[model samples]
Target: MKALKKSIYAEYDVHDAFQKIVLLEMQSYDGTKKQQLKAFLEDMQRSGCISGMISQFIYHADCKKFYIEHLDDLEDIRKEIEDCLGEAVKDRYGLPHYTFMCWLCFEEYCYDIYRNSFE
Candidate 1:
């Protein structure tokens, strides 16, 4: 039983999760912030930056004003995300540069090639 378990985790390469502030804003995407949302999506598409499935929502926030303040910072943050995800995904799928998945960091899922087992 122990030997079997050791074999399973030898290869694992991605798992990324972080507390996101923009997720709160995305919840109301269909409603009031439609215009802003359109612009944000278009900008990302044009820049070939952050693009992926954004589901599994959990928000407990209430604000009369939308989160317009981060408009400037959003581009920088998304560019970082794009860099991390890399262009490999685009080449693999033969898709446009704007297409991407929420792949976690490499270290978290990297296979320990040298290790016989994680002792």
Candidate 2:
């Protein structure tokens, strides 16, 4: 994990890259956030490419806030997310050891990380 974090840090400034990942993880469980993501995940799981699924999500997230009229500051943040997702997919995948159900369960794990980070 340290190696992965370092590699992502090299590609995107450490602060921005980590922040987005943390933010995504955090919001992933927020009630409203979960509702939004539930819809996306239903569609995403059909793709069957764990890496691509994660990448597309990160891609859309990086670009999401910027689509708002007053959220230009998010553009750079979005770009960084895209870069990380690109790198994560290039090397990683849905953990094959885990069943799809288990993999989906891991999203809750991510939410845990985000929650812990904030505390």
Candidate 3:
């Protein structure tokens, strides 16, 4: 809940180590927030969330800002997305279903991943 700063892979948990590999294999970042975002996008792609190249995720996905800022593991990022979506829906502020865009982005990214699979 506290932004996941306390748990960066949980002291070499195998699954956690694999998560780092997943992100690294997806894109290269200099340990910056951009890396976190790209990693999230890649995770979304694998999980059937959103799709195309990393560029598209950066261009249109509203949730990039949140991921870039949060810098947590995938599961926590996902929980936060759900919580944010609920809050965004409740409030009449920002864009219509503002946080919902994250969900939508995931869907698009998933489609992109599927489409690319055949190529």
Candidate 4:
């Protein structure tokens, strides 16, 4: 996907946007990959291809070593915690199913609208 092929700065920009929504709405992202997983989980309920999404998010976060040589988004770091949690929950049901799905859809829709507006 073009999004996956994009640079870490692009990924970071997306993550930062996610962080803003999470913070303004009291969402969580405890400084780990767990946030991505959480986003994927919610997405799975709707897309059913969350594993790929989760993988993409993880790769994006992991690539920070290459893209981010100085500072990280403070809110994004917090949300990453769920990315860590997502790893442990792959075999469990601790993830929020429906709410996460709604959130994922809303986030994606918002992202598309925002992206379109920018262009």
Q: Candidate 3, clashing residue pairs?
A: 49-106, 49-107, 50-106, 50-108, 50-109, 50-110, 51-108, 51-109
- Evaluate model 1: give its lDDT: 0.29
C-alpha lDDT score of every prediction, in listed order = 0.29, 0.37, 0.40, 0.37
Q: lDDT per residue, candidate 1, 1-119, as tens digits? A: 12222422223211112123223423455644444444333433343222332232111121101113222232344454466668432335443222212222111112211122233
For model 3, the local distance difference test gives 0.40
Whole-model alpha-carbon lDDT for candidate 2: 0.37
lDDT of 3 by residue, 4-119 (tens): 22332333232243334334444553455544544554555565322333333334344555434433443354455467567422322343332344444334333333344322
Q: Which stretches of candidate 2 lie over 4 Å from their true place?
A: 1-31, 56-119
Instruction: Give me candidate 2's TM-score against the actual structure.
Output: 0.22
At residue 28, candidate 1 shows an lDDT of 50
User: Which candidate leads in TM-score?
Assistant: 3
> Which scores higher on lDDT, 2 or 3?
3
Q: Model 4, 85-109: lDDT tens per residue?
A: 5642231334343323323433443
Relative to the true structure, candidate 3 reaches a TM of: 0.24
TM-score of predicted structure 1: 0.22
Give stretches of model 4 more than 4 Å off.
1-94
In model 3, which regions exceed 4 Å deviation?
1-96
Against the true structure, candidate 4 has what lDDT?
0.37
